[model samples]
Target: MKAIQAYRFALDLTPARERDVLAHAGAARVAHNWALARVKAVMQQRAAERTYGVPDEQLTPAVSWSLPGLRKAWNAAKAETTWNGGRLLVAGRRYPSSKTCSGCGAVKTKLALSERQSECEACGLVVDRDLNAARNLAALAAEFDTAGSGPVGGRGADRKTPLAGQAAAKRQHGTAFAGQTGTVPPQGGTTNRVPVQAY
Candidate 1:
């Protein structure tokens, strides 16, 4: 049981809410993929250099996934690109207990990636396209209404998910890992966990 802090934003999107949401989420995805690609390239290159005895001039500067830094990058890009209004923001403090089923809110821990779009079996509720996760985050933020909590575990892109082997492996390459499917939040990204059904 860890202390987590969350911030909830009312999308307050008009009829065009969905469109804007998607655009913004896509921006997040772009940022994540861009960051991931750059990081992976450099790490792999450096590893190879170490193995092959390459020189220092060829290596690139290390990129960080710190929230403030990433937010700066996002805001700068947002002025020039298309994006959503309310991007998801979870501080990732206490193992973010999001559930599926929207109705029952049963916190299943090991929800698989195949269950991307979820249907709440207990409450006959349905959620998809990452909205479910967003709703859950909203509820969580309300529940943990506080501030100034330190970063939780496994929220950072670099910290969460062992990417080195998964992407590099022939079979696992490109395979979506748990908690890495949808657009990641500024503090904590989307998770492959159950949605809080019904509510």
Candidate 2:
């Protein structure tokens, strides 16, 4: 007969270290959710095309679900730029960089793309549209560096996953009971028991 063993250990992480770990976890979740959403969107599109009597060959192309494929897709979608030395800074696509005035910190409600210049109504500062956007992005990069945070809040930050915090709150304590561990038995298999000390 063969035997299997498992071990668990807890780390004593400082506040900053814990925050960094949590940030990494959150980023992973975001990436996973983004990929999942992309897949689902493609599936829905294909289904709709089928309903419209579109031939399989004419339907939207399928997305690759493999790890490498997902990673490649994510890399293409994740618009990031190198800052300082090698640090990556990501600015949200929805940010009104071109419509925002670099001098007065004013955002125009409606700035036509044909307009090559951004004229600030609040401060009467006129600048090239691309130049204004560049300044705003630079300011955002500086702010991110100083705060040591992910993206800034406002129109630039993505929406949080629904009920994510609530789900985490419910699992504030360890899932397993003290001094015991639990595992879901495999199909047609007996429950395996293990004994261990709790922290």
Candidate 3:
């Protein structure tokens, strides 16, 4: 009822491309951990200063976990310099397509590394791998489509963060994402092109 539509971006990844994807993921993870550490450290420092009732400016700078900061960090990561994996466009925001599911709108749920295909038992959806996640992110992006939220993936704020931590089940990304697009991806995604897992 909320102007729901599918958002999908296709990435052309070869074995080399796959490596780049992994690299981008690694860079993102590093930035996240680094931001967290920085936040914790600054918080500690601020608490210590609080003993003397120091003012806000006197405290160490708090690490921002917003989306812009994350993009800046990722872009600056030397490891990911050559591996700029294309970002998935959801609603209008960018998100990690691999981690989320296309079937049930879950976030960061574990999909075995070996398990390229996503099968959503809860929704009875069967999906490929990449496309499935892409569609999931798309639906999530549209959750607040009317809110007119700006690009979500750019800043440290994940576009899908709003849907964080409620994955009781896994729905393949392509399970329904392909349907959103009008035509289903080839049965079993072609190696050259990532297939739509959910239908």
> Which candidate has the top score in lDDT?
2
Could you give candidate 2's per-residue lDDT for residues 2-39 as a string of tens digits? 66342222344467755665565556644655677777
Every candidate's lDDT:
0.54, 0.67, 0.57
Higher-TM-score candidate of 1 and 2: 2
Residues forming the 10-long window of minimal summed lDDT in candidate 1: 153-162
| Maximum-TM-score candidate | 2
Per-candidate clashes come to: 15, 0, 19
Q: Which stretches of candidate 1 lie over 4 Å from their true place?
A: 1-98, 144-199
Write candidate 3's Cα lDDT for 1-199 as tens digits: 5663332222433676456545655566445556767667778888999888889866655657556788787666733523333232324344646656565655555667788877765676677887786676666656644434565433434333233322344556545343244545677553334333331
Using all chains and alpha carbons, the TM-scores for the candidates as numbered come to: 0.30, 0.34, 0.25
After superposition on all C-alphas, the RMSD of every candidate to the true structure, in Å, is 32.4, 25.1, 28.4
Error of 3 at 138 (Å): 0.9
Error of 1 at 97 (Å): 5.2
